[model samples]
Target: MQRIGWTRPTAKTMRDMLHIGAPIFAELFLVSLFVMVDTALLKPCGTTAIAAVGLTAEPINVLEFLFFAVQTAVIARMARASAKNDRNAIHAIIRGYLKLTLASAALLAVLTGVFAVPFLTLFGGTADTLPIAVPYFQISLLAFVCRRMYGAMATILKGLDKPQWSFLLNLIANGINIVGDIVLINGYGPFPKLGALGAAVATVSGCAVGLVCAVVVMRDQLRAREIRIPLSDWLRSTWRETRAICTEALPMAGEKVMIRLGIFLSITRIAALGTTAFAAYRILISLQNFAYLGAEAVATTALIFLSKAYANHDRKAAQDAFSAAMVYGLAFSSLCAVLFFAVPGFLMSCYSDDPQVLSEGVRVLRIIFLYQPFQAVALIYASGMRSCRRAGIPSIITTVGIVLVRPSLVYLLAGPLGVCGAWIAIMTDEIVRCVLLFALRGKMWRQFTDAPTPSPAVV
Candidate 1:
């Protein structure tokens, strides 16, 4: 086959990635800032509130990962459909995944709300924190449906090469959340002070608004493309697409489950270190997540464009996009590491006034900063693998790192190294995952090229 024209890693393509990745970076960073704002604002409520929120994070992450798996599945498949010019397949996949995810979200919301106490208690929620944690968990869980809609629509836009639309929608959502945080958390003017619950309310409300905005943007995009699905056939198409989506999503979901479980175990260990230690971790983790925004954005772009490249059978384009994505991921993540090292104290101080908490937070931040680049490489490589429909190996590698090695290291090290030990466990996990996933990049390339052309547009 002649090397078909596709996006090559020329100056123009590089510029395209920057333009695509910049807003994605901002979007992710803004989302992280939601947690940052919550942690910072709730500090006045006392350390228990912070610990409560921190404890709830593990379970919430599991839910986010589930939806994220669905989003990735959508992007991986839709990229191919777009590349193949299969308008019908794209529409079917979008409708199927959106409906399936929203249904899952709604069920999840109810289950989490009903079992909020039991779930929080499993994470070492105490009497004092449970009162705060349970309400927050209940209200926040209800937002899962909204979040699912927002994430699915955003992923669809990305697959269609319309990332700016998602970015703009997310920016509006973040603005709403920040304003809501100020008003609800502090009882600005007439609003009553609701503490931790208020933070949950603001974030959930923001997600709901984001879903609405995303729908509006997506409608315009679809209309522009003149893509319309007949209502009578919608359910029939959705059911057919569901089977295909689930086949792709299951392995990724397993990977997410294992990773979240690892974090869950790590959180349990951190809780044993006491409220001050966990609180410090909460603050430092928020900062660490902020740093990871760049890597996440690059990984997202890699998945969409690389999938498109491969779907078009353009190996060189795939290679170029993957290379450019890794470079972008590492560059931004390394900069974050530098910032973390230079001003760890200031970053911690933003979240807490407690001296011991600040000391612990700074120590954790420095340790985590050292491993950010490794995480960047790992995320990009894994995303590339997934884009090529070789998700199984990456999923296995992640499962081992998160479910077995990391938690064991944490369990053995936390007693001796305190919060630093927990940080070391995570760093170790990132390094292992990076090495393993990087080694498999060639295999992924071969797997995609050597395999028979898939039926229709199923990823």
Candidate 2:
């Protein structure tokens, strides 16, 4: 029987994952979709707006990557304690995570606030983009503190097997942001137009609502679970773990930077074909998130299950979880790929009315669909490594493949095939990562399990 903090998910576990995961997938996908919407709506305003928002994205992603790294570690530790039936440990981790997240968020917020413009310039901004990016960047970073807080809280609930609440809160928030998009961007009865600034404001407001809802929903978990965190003990352990998290997380951050830059360069190439191509690519990217969520969900679910198994010293259980999760991920991606082919223009039309944007988006998105299954494989195993607390290696390997191999090929190919060439470059990177990571997955699991650790004391 399941007790306070203990859980031994059976075959039914995967089914639970599906129910809880669907909302999470929706929320995550919509967050990206909102970004696409932000860009698409501003398209009439022009490329300055697109580049303005785009310039700020890499920096925002950097902040999120840091938050996610800590959150990932939190989930792993929380899952370990839960597997060993330690409710007290849940409280302790939450307390520690709360303090750490707040402190980190504040520091980063100050740094980003002070250096927002310079950072945007570093990502390749010009004077025309700066004015638009300035307001967008400033206001968006204001929400990162709340965002990081939500990250820790969401990880706590998800690791404890109450992921549905976390997902629901995010969806609710995104829903608010979507409505705000139309109202604020175009101006409602009394509301004045804010354009890109409106999008940023909408995002911050939505996040505020979501953060409060998530905390409220998980109030029982917070209060009912008794916690006694000793500051001295926390200082010692948190310091060590914090350092270790960075060693692991920095590469993950770097990998994201690689992706952001590669896309940036790809945009530079696509922009040559004019705003229609650039705008088209952005829309297609937003649509791809719907297909991409399966892989993201697999990665997240795999990490939780693997961390639990590794903590319990159950090598066989870990293998079972990984294989079962991965097969489902593959099936999910395959289905999405089929939809992409069968319904080409449907996704493109959501973003724009321009015939060129629609046509180019259809052509490019169809080819990208061919690579979706491969992207799923890469996400599953790379995240499997994260579950084992060995994310660095895979991050490095994929980063090299993406930032170096992929973009270099795109540069070579784009001249001949334009944006289509850029898409091929991305496809090649996903395929390579899929093959390499899958090949190494078994060996890596074996190596990690060879020295499995027992669950530690909870409180």
Candidate 3:
């Protein structure tokens, strides 16, 4: 009887996971904090403003998926290149994706801005919310290119095992956003109060600064010598790299679209429950983002390690890395669960003082906490599989849970259980995905460890 691969995480493995994961956790925490602060700043404007901003959340995430998909491909390729110490490949991947990110973001931003109202309405925006949401969304779209570029650079840094640089970049950007929200939203000093619109402006400003800083830092870090090439050859190489990125990115983008569609439907159902219910849902989601911060960090860290391990074909090291990531992710999720259970009221109060919102939020938040550990398991294992370049099964599993099962549960349950029912559906979806991913992980371990060294082309 052999022990499982994850049962044997070495001390150095644990140390490495922490070193990489801590900054990512901090970066995510800061980003979530800025969101909560932005929500709080809008409170004085009224619940409609909060709900209006929340209406744009899923849509914005849907837009971001394009950038994230490209970033994922960049990370995967860059990680492999890093493992092989192929500096030119790393530089080439960075250059190709930066161009793709900018062009795509610019075009998407224009289209989304042009059809802002229809887009918002499609995502469950009520008449009252649309007037506010439309302009806020359009203004926020100004940040899209900047956000995409910054994200591209950050992913590159992380893939190269330089997460601290990414952390610093986020810290500066989020700090600016926090201060800008305070000044612009409330009319501080020379700035006029613009309410929800102010939040959008602050976001644009922060992303712009982050993008500039990222470009400068990336240039300094790479320091690759310029190799003169024929113009035609350069264009050909760029196209080839871009095509490779799109090849890996398409499945990931499809997965994201399905997941966002499910969320869009769920939010629409919650919005149909009326403004107060929707506002409460928004606040709870923000708090839920906190719970996910560490899990995402662990998953990302595992992805980087696993990518390198796959390149090296070191099964034991890959196993140890996965083990450490799960341990850390579960531990952090348990801590968040305890907090959610212990002080649900206090957490909800930070965003809203309305009795109806607080009562509903506290109830659903308690239910939400129950799924954290399971959710952590699903995220980490799915990411582990993705690093193995076995993303198709995990993507299929996620699509089924999010696209089909979760939304169906929401539709069936929301009528009987109210907003709480929707959350219960979410929890059930996480549990289902967790169980499936666990089984898939076992199968992956058997195949991966038993197999001979894989070809570089496959890896």
Instruction: Give per-residue CA lDDT, model 3, range 56-166, as digits (tens).
Output: 987898788767767766777778778877666765676678778878889988998999988889888998999999999998888777888898889888888888889
Worst 10 residues of 1 by lDDT: 1-10
Considering only N, C-alpha and C atoms within 3 Å, which residue pairs clash in candidate 1?
Answer: none
The TM-score that candidate 3 achieves is 0.88
Backbone clashes in model 2, listed as residue pairs: none
Comparison by TM-score, 2 against 3, better one: 3
CA lDDT, every prediction? 0.82, 0.74, 0.82
Cα-based lDDT at residue 234, candidate 1: 50
What is the alpha-carbon lDDT for the whole of candidate 2? 0.74
Who wins the lDDT comparison? 3
